[model samples]
Target: MSDAHTADEGRAPRRVLVVMAHPDDVDYGAAGTVARWTAAGHDVRYCVVTDGDAGAEDPETDRAALAATRRGEQRDAAAVVGVKDVTFLGYPDGRVETGLALRRDVARVIRRCRPDLVLTHSPDRDLVHVKASHPDHRAVGSAVLDAVYPDARNPCAFPELLHQDGLAAWTVPEVWVRGGPVTNHHVDVTDTFHLKMTAIRAHVSQGGQSAEFEETMRARLAALARDAGLPDGRLCEAYLRIDTR
Candidate 1:
């Protein structure tokens, strides 16, 4: 895992595809890195697998309204980081599965984007991150991994994609999975921490107790950076890097 993405100086993936289960999923761990990537001229696109209709915990929360709100919030969040392309698969939130349908959808985006790198959720469900390892997250991760491999790379895997959509096969070189038991890569995001917070703020429905959440989030970021071996006061995002090639 460590060998897959050692970040050779000045070498960056030309195009990056980020796949996640819900609207704010990517913002939780990788928003800062996304900002940094876009700042460096790397093209990053987001593929959100679900509408996140089931995100609100309150029984009175209007699911449909919440879904629409989340989608708009996500678009705003993406724009904050300079990302213009965001694809919402429109799958039912909290019920996504690693089925052929999910694979096909992910494969379509991968082929269309032709990204050299893909970032997604970790496949494993560690005890430390039971919430992050939600079933929907795991399902999306498994499907994304499969789609990045044979489904997106093999021309014959989904013939309809070629005959109907005109998408060609695409082979992605590397995938970096966020939030797992083992972290092999750390993206220094000190300079882009503020941008990350701004992006996170776009999800107005997700935050709580403004002052408390902001303070807690800052502390969490600091702890994450320290645990990931970053220099003092530097912000970092950890990932389990995998070589798809």
Candidate 2:
């Protein structure tokens, strides 16, 4: 991971696409890193697989309205991290499945974006922290990985994309999996941590309005920085970097 980071440290800005399950997933996992990239002049886009309609605990909540609200919230959140492009796939929040449909849809975005790097959740479950391994997250991860490989790059995998939408095959060079059990890459995000919090705070409907949530996130990031051997007071975001090239 360090070698990879060093290799690309001072390279020209590359396009980055973040694919996530819900509105706030990016803010929770990669907002700080995203801030750094944007500040460095990288192009960034977001493809949210779901609208997070099932996020609320209230049984009587209007799912459709909630979904709309979440989409708006996600757009606002992305703005905080200097990302202006956001695409919502409108998949059911909690019922996302790793299927051909999802793979193809994600592939479409890949071709459209032609991103050099794709950031997503971990397909593998984390038994240590079950709460973080949401089923939808894993599903999106698996689908996106598949899309980045055979589906998006292979011309025959999704022929309709080329024939109908004129989206050509795109091969993503690398992928960074967030919230995975194993992490080999660490981004020193101390400078952008506040932006991360501000992005998360945009998801007010999902408890991001709470000051306690911000403090908790701060503590967690600090702990991660320590684990990554960073000096005290620094903050970081960790990822399992996979080379797809």
Candidate 3:
């Protein structure tokens, strides 16, 4: 719940790693902020936890085809935000688990990326609204937090990551969890909202083009920024800061 923002002005720009459960999760939530970060010359990497095989509408689409299509879409979306390094763990689309195996995998990425800040789905999900609180999102978010904490920082927690993966222990100073009830910080992304929209649009195979859907998405982000006292036309992304130190 810390409001302490990391000042990137004086120090060398640090890498920012964003982890999500699905292909379009970052586009729907964190793309704007990611655009801002990349524009600021920060290195940004995306780690997608799922293959998103269940995201297509055409039941005739095979799992392999769906996964390949989603990977391409995610790459296109990531490119929109200037994110070139994207990793997909290939976990089942809707059945991510917050277990040691998953935690260790996340920790391996954190250690390899050595990010100063990590972003993932909000832990305190909206229970009343099932659409916004997907179980996979919750699972990935929780696993990322665990990986960022004692797991990633403590050498003993995931020693294999260090030995086999050439990843050293890394302690991310801050974490930003999006799409939750307990928002404590907002980033002004008006300049990048278009890029965000483009990123979201790249997931066309996932049915992101409906007029109603677009309007609702824009309105929600606008309302979120407004509620945080940001100016009009200043689109924003909100987060709950989890400071490890």
Best by the lDDT measure: 2
**Which number leads on TM-score?**
2
| Weakest 10 consecutive residues of candidate 3 by summed lDDT | 1-10
Task: Rank the models by TM-score, top first.
Answer: 2, 1, 3
For model 2, residues 216-239, the per-residue Cα lDDT tens digits are 888998888888887899888888
Whole-model Cα lDDT per candidate? 0.86, 0.90, 0.85
The reply for model 2, stretches above 4 Å from the true place, is: 1-9
Residue-by-residue lDDT tens digits, candidate 1, 132-167: 789898899899999998899999998999999999
For model 1, what is the C-alpha lDDT against the true structure? 0.86
lDDT for predicted candidate 2 compared with the true structure: 0.90
